[model samples]
Target: MSHLEREIAEQPQVLRTLLRAQAAPVGAIAAAIKRFQPAFVQIAARGTSDNAARYAQYLMGIVLRMPVGLAAPSVHTLYGAQPNLARALVIGISQSGKSVDVLQVISDARAQGALTLSITNDANSPLAQAAEYHIPLHAGEERAVAATKTYTAELAAVALLVTALADDDAMRAALNAVPDALDATLTLCDPIAGWAQRYRYMPQLACIGRGYNYCTAFEINLKVTELCYITGVGFSEADFLHGPIAQISPGFPVLVVAPSGKTLPTLLTFLEKLKARQAEALVIASDEAAFVHAQQQMRIPAATPEWLTPITAVMPGQVFAMQLAAAKGYDLDNPLGLTKVTLTL
Candidate 1:
């Protein structure tokens, strides 16, 4: 197995470890956040970490009922402008925690009176040191160019952080179920590998979802593009209907993440439309009935409260991307020009 595959398989355990070890620290951070009582939340990240931040954005907005915005690091790193963030909670997420621009944003946000936090695997890294509070990913070292364990670890960390802030027992319990759900998701590997052979020659595809899982669509799209060298575009189901649906032709490949939730009905309707167009849809869903209209499906064990589904629903897509890359004879551990840690400024 390649390093990427090994790291991919390590996620279930990594998530379990993160929750087991970091719950207290996460709670402490939550206490700090409550003390600060920021009026808004801003997240700064890049690449896979940025996609995880998108998940955080949705969680904070829906659960905390606070406005969440993704920070434009260039505004601080390039324009050298410091917008007022006196009542903001600024979070910087990175696996290596060494990105120059991400750290700079955290520094500036702190200088502007924002309560700054960082989520990173390296507790001693510069980004962690820069933030007032740090949440360690506890994912260990990830040597693969395409991140696997760290991304899921980020999801788990975000879930813990949100649950801590909300102090909701149900959400906390839902998160506790994620590791087991992911273990079940890994059992689909044999079938997903069989399914991947059919798409070995696929040059491009679309990944679609809505609400919280929209970030999963983007993360899956990134995995495919980075590991398999395919042109994979991610879109919210609503946005896809707003004219991007015109690009679909008969037998075109489309992947949908439709775990059971409030958004499931709309996703099923979208699947029906895809069926009418004869578009091949491979849906990752917890509800088997939701697969009736799709060309193929991978069923994950149901995770409650729906919002927490992204943590587990994303596993099948990760497996599919890894298997498809291998089927296409690409190096999973090392993409053409990509490195394990990407530094952007």
Candidate 2:
């Protein structure tokens, strides 16, 4: 079995359940919010962590109406951006609580008066200690350097932060149900893996989303390139029409993440345009019936409150990238030229 196929094969029990259990940390983040609510919020991460943090930053600024910033660990240590350190709630997202650059960024945030919080799998790592407050991801020592469970746990932290900021108790309840929904999403991993292996040779692919998931497109694109050594691009549904449409040629796959959200209509409209352009589209949609296609559709569970779609929607691409790499006999546990922990401090 391919590394991704094996990961998917194991999803029926262990790691998938680990991904589902993310709600456990949500309560801790809620408590952290009550303890530290700064005017500005900054996220610390590197590479994939930064990709996840970018999604969280969008959720904070656009979803929760908070002043959120993406803190580059190098900028604080190398150039020294005081703007991120001033009264900001710096949340560091690292699988290992010891990423050198992420730690320095959080430490700098603290030195300049920002409230620091670290969400990491390693409870005892230095990154955890650097934060004034800590909400450990508890993904339980993910060995795969590609980082699946840790990514899900970080988004749980983001959802927890958003839920805590909202005054609506009903929304909090809705947010709490995400893990169960995520449990259902794990079922599609194998199907996505099957597709990735079959389509590995495709030169280009599209990963599109809207609102908060617009950032998911970037992260997904990153993963595909990082793992599969193939080129893929992520964009918003609205942004595709402006210029990118010209690039949609035959045999090019368009992977659309269409969750049933406020932007569904716009995304569907964009897909229709792709269809009219005669481009092959493989939609990873919750409402699969809404889209008719000759190729099989891999549908995950629907996302509630619409905003949390990115949390579930990104999983398929995560699996797809790994599967594509695994198809080429690449070991996903540690992709070449990648490290478990990145420390630049």
Candidate 3:
């Protein structure tokens, strides 16, 4: 197997390993967060890690009732502006702890008396050293240029932190079961490969989701774009209806991450509209009924909690992107002009 495919297959064990190793440290970080009692949160990340931050934005907001914002690193790196963060909890997320811009954000936030934490695969790396608290991903070394294990490990890290903060026993139990859920989700690989072959010639497409899986939409879109060299776009189900809906032409492909949740009703309605416009939809959902309007359907583990679905939902996307890139005869381990670690200023 290729490095990318092996890394993708390793995610179930990665989550199992991460939760087993980092639970106590994550709890300690949660304890520190509560003691600090920050007014709000700001996260700095880039590329795929940024998509994981989007998961945190919704997770923190829904569970902790804390307002979270994605930090614009250029504000500090380019403009040299220091915004007041004295009452904030600043977080930095990166697969490699080598992003200089992300490191600068943590350093600046610490200088401003903000409580800073970092989630990264490397505990000895610079970004980990800069934060007051750190949660190691325990994902080990990822040799693939496109991240699969590390990205899921990042989401698990974020989910672990939030679950600890809430101190909810039931949610913590749910978190423990995620590895099995991921294993079950991986069973869809053969079907995903078939789907990828069916769309091997696809030049462009749209990915849509809402609530927590909103991050899934963006992450999957990035995977396809980078690995398969497709012009993929991501959108929230609500936002797609506003102006971009007009762009849909006959036989256009749309990938929808529609797990069984509060957003399912609205997504069903959105699927109806896609049908009316002759847009074909491939839905990644737990609800078998959701396939009523879809041209293709990939099922995830049905028992995973809605909040934790992103951890499992992303498997099919990763598999599809990997399969699609292989079908297109592209190198899976290294994409053109891309490296394992990108340190942006």
Best prediction by TM-score: 3
RMSD of each: 1.0, 3.2, 0.8
Model 2 C-alpha lDDT versus the unseen true structure: 0.71
Candidate 1 lDDT, tens digit per residue, 1-345?
A: 788888888998998899999999899999999999998999999999999999999999999998999999999998998878878999999999999999999999899899999999999999999999999988989988888899999988998999999999888888898888788888865588877889999888999999999999999999989988889999999999999999999999999999898899999999999999999999999798789988778888874558878877788888898989888988889999998888888
**Model 2 clash number:** 2
Model 2: per-residue Cα lDDT over 78-182, one tens digit each = 776655466678888887877877888777778887778887777788988888777666555566667666676677666666766665678667766776676
- Give the alpha-carbon lDDT of every model: 0.90, 0.71, 0.93
TM-score-best of 1 and 3: 3
Model 3 clashing-pair count:
0
Angstrom error at residue 11, model 2: 7.5
Clashing pairs in 3: none
Return the TM-score for each candidate structure.
0.98, 0.86, 0.99
Q: How far is candidate 1 from the true structure (C-alpha RMSD, Å)?
A: 1.0
Residue runs of model 2 more than 4 Å from their true location after superposition? 1-37, 293-296
